[model samples]
Target chain A: MKNMYEILINALQADELIAQVTILNGSNVGEKLLLWPDGRKYGGLGSEKLEKQIIEKAKELFQRQETRKLEFELDEGRISIFIQVYPPSPRMIVVGAVHIAVPLTELGKTMGFRTIVVDARSAFATRERFPHVDEIIVKWPSEALEALHPDEGTYVAILSHDAKFDIPALQVPVQSKAKYVGVLASKHTYSILHEALRENGVSEALLGKVHTPIGIKKLGSRGPEGIAFSVMAEMIAEMRGVEIT
Target chain B: MRDVMENISNWREEGKQIVLATVVKAYGSALRPIGSKMAISSAGDISGSVSGGCVESAVYEEAQSVLANSEPRLVEYGIADETAWSVGLTCGGTIEVFLELLD
Candidate 1:
């Protein structure tokens, strides 16, 4: 009984991946069709043929995770539909609740990411320290990542400077489908960590994906807040598909 | 859409008629990306924005007409448009906005 707008709002609120197709041109202007990833559809554009065409186009857009406007030529006339895909919001998973994690999480939240903080040190990963983070997990990085299941929409930051923690933390994200995995380490530390990860059986291809000495180059930024800024800049670049040499 | 959802829901709860305007296409350095949206209530209240304060007033006016007739419309703004120049996109971009009543 709910209207299409209410239904669309509910689906978005529930964090469900959905595609909304709006007829921008043609006799049925303003008509909409909602497509779920699981092949469920609602509403119509007045004709079975047009709906079928839109469903096919929606599937392709869903795969690309893109919003696009397409013009279709029919026997009657030209129909244009704006297809908008609503995916779950991206997440920022900080693997260490260090000083940088504070501003990093803050920046993540400001950038509309679901920020999470993880640390094995209970003393470090406290609500008092991360009062605004969406979630704080006081567990080893590997375990936390395993439970969280980092997906292609997740950006992982390994700020556990110590190798004992860093090595284990690096292992999980490097093998998972996380979109970005950045580590805060100096050149010397990165080389050492690189060897250790290789010893742990991480493939060269996967290890190559890890962003070392993390953050934008030549930033000249120093200290916790500065480093966090650079790291976030790099993450944004990655998220927006911008390449920075 | 997410950015304007809270205000849209609040306006809906107050029984205000609403129009949702979305930027369906942006060409040349548009300030807001495609799919950016703004919600306009019948009382002239607005939430979110589709441009960098360049065209909200114009879009708001169009939304009022849509609310009156319950007809959706597509509006375009560009620096080259003489009428749009009065409330043009200072960013020198062309944008096509789709306005529809939120039923």
Candidate 2:
């Protein structure tokens, strides 16, 4: 038991992403689930079998580094386990750093998110506009997106709101695990642009992730700044699993 | 927790008695994840966390001992440890703790 403690500590110190499941209500009540990278396991929430089974489930979620509380039915009683998945923070890629990019970039920075802004036009994509923004790439979407490595938490917002720019930009980030993909556009523009994506072979499921008119539903008069706030709010809602309801 | 490191070091150099209690490891449902750290000083200053409000009390006691002994130690806590979540990770997850005392 003590050796298990040391091993777990070492793994955490090395920055390994591992889920820690606690049996909140059960006979095993305090048993642990220590699942390693290779799917091998140690410790138990109850018995070896229960631990093994939970570990397998944990590994599946661990790959994505998602957090969820689990409820399990056992022969002896009803069991509930709370699982906290540990994955690295996702990157946020903002296409076209305009006035709206300023607030979005600042918010992302405060929230421990890695933010990137790209623009084909060097004048708009200068470091002066986005001082704290990471990776100011002055290139087309294909060039910039190809260079960026997208993972689960990657968020791409098509702030360009320009067809030629937004269209090309969508191709690179749409397929990635960016849970929140927001494009700044009005309802009419989104309908038109979304159709364009569909025609270009983007699947309905993938296109569904594209948040056109991204952000919380407008509460008052809408403009460029309002649109930026709403879109960022939407991104935050999606990132933290928050819903307006 | 990384945010608290510099402050903790600053206070240590200032000669305030301090101890660091870190969530070195957590099992299933920890309030704070592993690697979360909280530094508590003799003056009752604190920064960061191991669990939510769940485990701070136990951590404080362990921290005080480390401060008194002037030695580092590990405190293992969980629902199964017979302590039964008394001022601990009441979320039922177990956490292995590392404590370092500073002069």
Candidate 3:
């Protein structure tokens, strides 16, 4: 009987992704679910009935490499397994590589988001400034984002603070289902641009998802670091949906 | 247990015979948040996770076994829970655990 931890460490070391499902809260506090890409499965939390149900759920999230917290008590709370699915690390795509992008990229990586900084100007997106970035693309936002296969887990932050660069990056996520979409600008300017999105046929629902006045709160941030931190904070809120206290 | 790798490694440096447990699969919804892990030593010391607190006491027993026998084993919890009031997998999901002795 190979311990679940060893099996997973092997998988991760081999670059083979495996999802480990556990009971975080409620009943069945420590039930286990082992999911594989090849559809091979193992273990049971509590009941055969519940195990089958969780497997079905795990399969769905496994494909997306999504980590989710769920609550269930249909069996009258007998088996409440809060499944936290751990797949692979999610990737983040930044459309602009500028002065602020350098620090932002490094901080993003520290937070575990795979960062890619892109810019049409090679001088700005140089590897020297953004060493932590997994990839540096000297291309337009549309081209770079599309090439990255922007998905629901993808986070695209428009840090150029320029209409030309910001608009294209914003539009890409609007067209695809990028998880987090943010534009660096003031609230007033964002509202005007947001209105334009609706007029341009982008749905109101999607437009609402954009984080304008980017970042959490500009306590006293006036320089590039402040802007970068603000943007990163807002992005963190959007990704985790963490509410302000 | 990527998150707990540092702690496990620290214990390993101390020459602790560590036993690890991880949830490899999940069905419906389970508890303790999947991908959770727990590392235990033959000296009865432990860290990390596999589930919430409810099953830690139970899983520890198995982990201690690993430290003693130096072999891995698969353990199950909840089992399609029956009593809604008990501390079981309320999500109605199932999970499989793969336990290993980290030498």
Best by TM-score: 1
Would you list the clashing residue pairs of candidate 2?
A20-B28, A21-B28, A22-B28, A215-A230
User: If both were scored by TM-score, which would come out higher, candidate 2 or candidate 3?
Assistant: 2
CA displacement after TM-score superposition, residue B61 of candidate 2 (Å): 8.2
Question: Which wins on TM-score, candidate 1 or candidate 3?
Answer: 1
When sorted by DockQ, best at the front, the candidate numbers are 1, 3, 2
Candidate 3 docking classification: incorrect
Candidate 2: segments with Cα more than 4 A from true spot: A1-86, A218-229, A240-245, B1-18, B23-35, B40-47, B50-65, B71-98, B101-103
Q: What is the C-alpha lDDT of each candidate?
A: 0.91, 0.72, 0.70
- Poorest lDDT segment (10 consecutive residues) of candidate 1 chain A: A213-222
Q: What are the TM-scores, per candidate, against the unseen true structure? A: 0.90, 0.60, 0.59
Higher-TM-score candidate among 1 and 2? 1
lDDT of 3 by residue, A1-245 (tens): 97765666676644456766656434455566677867787666766776677778877877777666555555656433545455555567777787878777777876767788888988888888887788899988878877888776687788787776777667778778787887877877677677767777898888877776666664556577887777777678767878753
- In every candidate, how many clashes are there? 0, 4, 68
Please say which candidate is ahead in lDDT: 1 or 2.
1
Looking at candidate 2 chain B, the ten consecutive residues that score lowest on lDDT are B1-10
Error of 3 at A216 (Å): 1.1
In Å, residue B98's CA in model 3 sits off its true spot by 10
Chain A of candidate 1: what's the TM-score? 0.87
DockQ of each: 0.81, 0.09, 0.10
Question: Candidate 1 at residue A106, lDDT?
Answer: 95
